[model samples]
Target: MTGMFPATSMPDRDWWEALWPDPSGLLLSLGVEPSMTALDLCCGDGYFTAPLAKIVSGRVYALDLDPEMIVAAKAEVKHLGVSVLKWIVADAGDVAELIPEKIDFALIANTFHGVPDQPALVKAVARTLKPRGLFALVNWHQLPREHTTVLGQPRGPRAEMRMSPEAVAAVVEAAGFRLLRVVDLPPYHYGAVFEHKG
Candidate 1:
């Protein structure tokens, strides 16, 4: 993931959770079902992965490119003492190889802008998902200059690197996904939900 924000940029686990309060609520708003099998692509620090494990009846595959991030995520979820999660240290684009089972949902949050090959990544997600499976993406919205230049911004990619919702939808559609809906995630982000055409 060249030209991407490094894992070091991520805050401590608690701090990160505080920043994105109520991840479960957000997932539910995005149509994440409790019994669905999910793949948390680039699941850094288990911010979403841990909660996903709690909700999903099947399994949650938490995969990341950074080994340290995976280690931290595993530790973060260990308190729950649940075996619903399979933590894998791998690129987000290798979902087909890394996850053998057909996924009911795939969540890519906050890291889509940093992905080196957007089309390839989407294709991989499509390949791993079951027919009509959902792919939810939460990404930083590319706003105008005035909105993005806040001093001492705690997080988010560079302004130029951020992808607009339209841009994201094009990539998703090119990979054989049907764009379903777009929702405002509030506080500087938006979510796009798509379904694998199969």
Candidate 2:
């Protein structure tokens, strides 16, 4: 098991822009439009959110808990001239409180399992989206062995912080989201698109 992952302070613009999920191609595959407002939950540095803002010329609420990470994400958006993304400080419990309305899309990318109360989050984010809103749930596929990043960086979370797809799916379905697609293409990590049921 790995130790507590530190919030690496990214002083440079590139590092902040690089801190999100890589399976963005999957996001593209989901048919994201250029005029729909979206919410990016646990949006670390909002990397994907940046690209997403470009696609949706609409607003993106980039929500996260880490203050420095939130700051870095906003900086990146400003640097990239992305006027559509808004940074909101939030954890699992405070998301609904921050944005108490519906959005066209909701993205929980790469950071769902880190949440302490998974069920609460499922319900909270579900309430925040419009009926039939598209929600992309993405996480690392359970790899067979520990892996290293290309930069020789070890990547693994503490055992208590990880969650499996089936386990997560149960919570999401219970919150009224119907699984629309299960993407298992390449490079390992998995994602499920849940269409919020009205």
Candidate 3:
């Protein structure tokens, strides 16, 4: 584990929603299917977790390093009256050991850039997923932070930390995954989907 992902990678909820008004729709566009078990890796406050649980018939595992974040995520899921398969508070690298079963899909949104050893984290995710499972990373396009504002405030990680789709694909592919496709997320982000080569 490269420790917790940098906090700057996460933004306030208001701007987060402003940037992604339809999280569930976004997830679907990223190829999340209702029948596949999913994992919300580095799940911040569960903004997407609640909707993810809704999509996968509550067969979603939400994990974050911060306990407070888990509490908030639990509240969010409760507010929606949906349940997650498990709400785990642990480092992202510990995902394989923490989840009871291999997942069919995994998502790490907005937090991939800050990972100190990106390839290591990608390998960890690969280990947690079932063979041929999909892993999707939603990352800020390599644009200046000031230009990617939301709710009238510049959001997301620093400009230098932002990654282009090709850069992300390189790292993930090196970790025993095949690049599937990159989906344009508009405005300031993109989703890169990879299939585990296991």
Candidate 4:
């Protein structure tokens, strides 16, 4: 868990999964179903990706900026006998190209904070998702000036890239998504669901 995060994650997936253990259930609460096809953006080690694969019971594509993490996730999925998932590496922009258009659901999770190009990311998300598709985003709440950090600096105060629910909502809305549900997940993270505008 210590090295897994590389100072770039909300929390490494293994550590976070151990704490919450119910992101899949949370996704279910947001209407994720076996009948749908889904994508996991920034899926680190297939933590939520595995569960999403189960939930969709259809097609699952897990995208990650870190190729090492994607390789590890693919290994885990193979060990788990989960074959419906496809692991791909590259930025969300590359994902936008590969998936083309109209996926039923897409999730960014805590990865939004790591993305350097906010507009390109939002536009890519908008382009790939179907109208009415679900997009779930999760991130940490804002903290005071002395308790937050970015890119490994205990630099005091949450960076803008470490988007809050409202901030992420703004981006999604601006990209043609509408807010749907805001959910409390494990301790330091939360989830927001949105629907692509029709």
Query: Which rank order by TM-score, best down to worst?
Result: 3, 1, 4, 2
Question: Which 10-residue window of candidate 1 scores lowest in summed lDDT?
Answer: 1-10
lDDT of 4 by residue, 1-198 (tens): 113222355345545555557767877866678888888888887777777787777388888777888887787667666664566777676678878547888887666665666667778877778889888887666655345343333432255445678888877788888899888765556788989896
In order of listing, the candidates' clash counts read 0, 0, 0, 0
Give a tens-digit lDDT track for model 1, residues 111-137: 888676789999999999999999999
Clashing pairs in 4: none
Looking at candidate 4, the ten consecutive residues that score lowest on lDDT are 1-10
lDDT of 3 by residue, 1-198 (tens): 545666434557888778889999999988899999999999989989999999998999999988889999999999999999888988888788898888999999988888877888899899988999999999888888799888788777888888888889889999899988899887788999999989
Candidate 2 clashing pairs?
none
Q: Candidate 2 on 81-165: residue-level lDDT in tens?
A: 7865467765646677788567888887666766556787788888888898888887666653255132234443444455577
Greater lDDT among 1 and 3 belongs to 3
lDDT by candidate, in order shown: 0.79, 0.67, 0.88, 0.71
Q: How does candidate 1 score on lDDT?
A: 0.79
- How good is model 1 by TM-score? 0.88
Those runs of model 4 whose alpha carbons end farther than 4 Å from true positions after fitting are: 1-7, 10-14, 144-161
